[model samples]
Target chain A: MEYIIISTGFALALLGLWGILSQKNLIKIILGFTIFNTGINIVMVSIGYVRGKAAPILDVIKPSEAADKIVDPLPQALVLTAIVIGLGVTALMLVYALNLHREKNSLDINSFKDLKW
Target chain B: MIKKILIIGLLAGVGLIFFDLFNAYQGSEVLGKTGRYYAENGADEVGAANLVTAVIVTYRGLDTLGEVTILFLTAAIISFVLKFRREDFIPNRPVRITSELLDSASQVIVPVIFMVGIYIFINGHLTPGGGFQGGAVIASGVLLMIMANPNFGISHKVIAKVESISGIAFVLIGIMGIFLAGGFLDNRLLGLGNLGELFSAGVIPIIYTFIGLKVGAELSNILGTISHAQNEKN
Candidate 1:
């Protein structure tokens, strides 16, 4: 079941990548990038999962009893970090998009080609 | 069209092979063994039940520092890209608007969001959330305000001061770790006190808080600069 969910996330990510490659609108590209980023983070977090486990916090409960079941907390932490970094990048990209809009008066990427050979 | 289809088919075939190879080696204990090592030893050395946080803030403190530096650099680059000299830039015609409903909504919600961000950052060491996550949340709150009031702008000077102070404090705390604990960003500098306590991670929470503040300010500043530039261009 976990693997199924993870594969679904990966498929979504691939779809997003396809959108990014094929889309003409800059905003669509940015949205695609976001989709891709979220999918990857979900995959990373899922990789650290242990079945039927609670979070890795101490007692509150007995350690010896719960040791066999606690889910790894490390990937959760790493994914949190990744999410923040993704936000920063997305925000930066939005700023760039605004700049592009100002310069070109349009949000279409194909229309703003200045460096084409 | 035919060429595109052929290329995609080739790629799919290659992907299938890779998938098969991965499945063939699946359920092996190679990486799982390493995880088990940390799962066993992490509780003792870090004093935190969450091995992830222990690894992130303590074992990989240097990586965190570097990541913070990257954020700082990004802010710098963004500010540079959108910078306007006082004399050369012309302010665009201001768009007048009146929206009492929007203003009232923002006024009510912004403080709550800000509080939540602070709570997240402060309790990061103890809980799943941390400074980076909280900082971004705070920035989103600021973004909410920005969206609600087009005329309202963050004071550039105040933001600059906040960013610089927080950035400097983050580094200073790291240096304190070095001086006091004999290593840069050493979380054990202040003594890892009783486990699961707020201040137990030594300087980890402190550093994360500073990082949170810095990241929040920088993110807002980036958004502010872009909007300001757009207003100018218009």
Candidate 2:
């Protein structure tokens, strides 16, 4: 399960990277960015996965026994934080895309060559 | 042609690394020391049944604070950059009403959905969910209302009030922790009521309540601004 998850996540990240590097449409690039974010989250989550362990909820078992039974809470906590921040970044990027579209009347990012050296 | 080859080469390098990682990743059979510590002592130390909640709200609290600030600023910037003239705004074209039944059904269902969001956040410490999930759910409920009635609008005043008050309360509670408990954002501000109970986690539920309200308000505010701007541009 862990192997499958991590491999799939890596594949997704690669797909997103390809989209960003190849796609002309700004929106496609943004979609790729989100996919990449999701892939990173999946990898981070699977990294912390311990075989046959439950979630880190103390309600089901005594606190002393929780150490062996529970999966790592640290990665879950960090990933949750990362997901929230990723959403914010994506929203900001989208707004920027909208503004660019308004100014240039084009969604194709390649059309904006002002930065090309 | 060169760009394509270079890209392929880069992708191949990535593929190789992935293959290597995949081959080497033996699933951990033991929790890390910190994970072990949180799992064992979190209930007694933070009094929260959910260790993830304990980690986010109490252990790594300062990080959560910074995260919410990032959300607040992103929301502020989105609205700022996308400001549109209301007088010049063109409303959405009226789509033929698909189902009177669906529209009426939402009236009952939306409130229930909204309540479920509230329940999730309030019981965050004892459950799998926390503030962010609940807030997103509430925002979806508000969004459903928007779709059902094109003219239906949330008062910005109410949103702003809820946002500011909760944000203030969150900060104040963190400050109160300085005096009432150990460090900043400490969960032991009050007595750890009871394990696995509604109010068992001191300050966690309160903090999550504030977070849920603030996040919901921010998301709704973002949606409101975007929809209005799109209408104006169209």
The DockQ of predicted model 1 stands at 0.39
Cα TM-score of candidate 1? 0.87
Chain A TM-score compared with the true chain A, each model in order = 0.91, 0.96
Q: Scored by Cα lDDT, where does model 2 land?
A: 0.88
Best by lDDT: 2
Clashing pairs in 2: none
Off by over 4 Å in 2: B85-87, B90-102
Stretch of 10 with least lDDT, candidate 2 chain B: B89-98
What are the clash counts of all predictions, listed in order? 0, 0
Candidate-wise lDDT, in order: 0.72, 0.88
For model 1, the superposed segments whose C-alpha errors exceed 4 Å read A59-67, B2-31, B84-93, B96-98
Residue-level lDDT of model 2, residues A12-103, one tens digit each, is 98898888888889999999999989988998999999999998887777787888898999999999999999999998999999988988
lDDT tens digits, residue span B128-155, model 2:
9999989999998988877776656678
Stretch of 10 with least lDDT, candidate 2 chain A:
A55-64
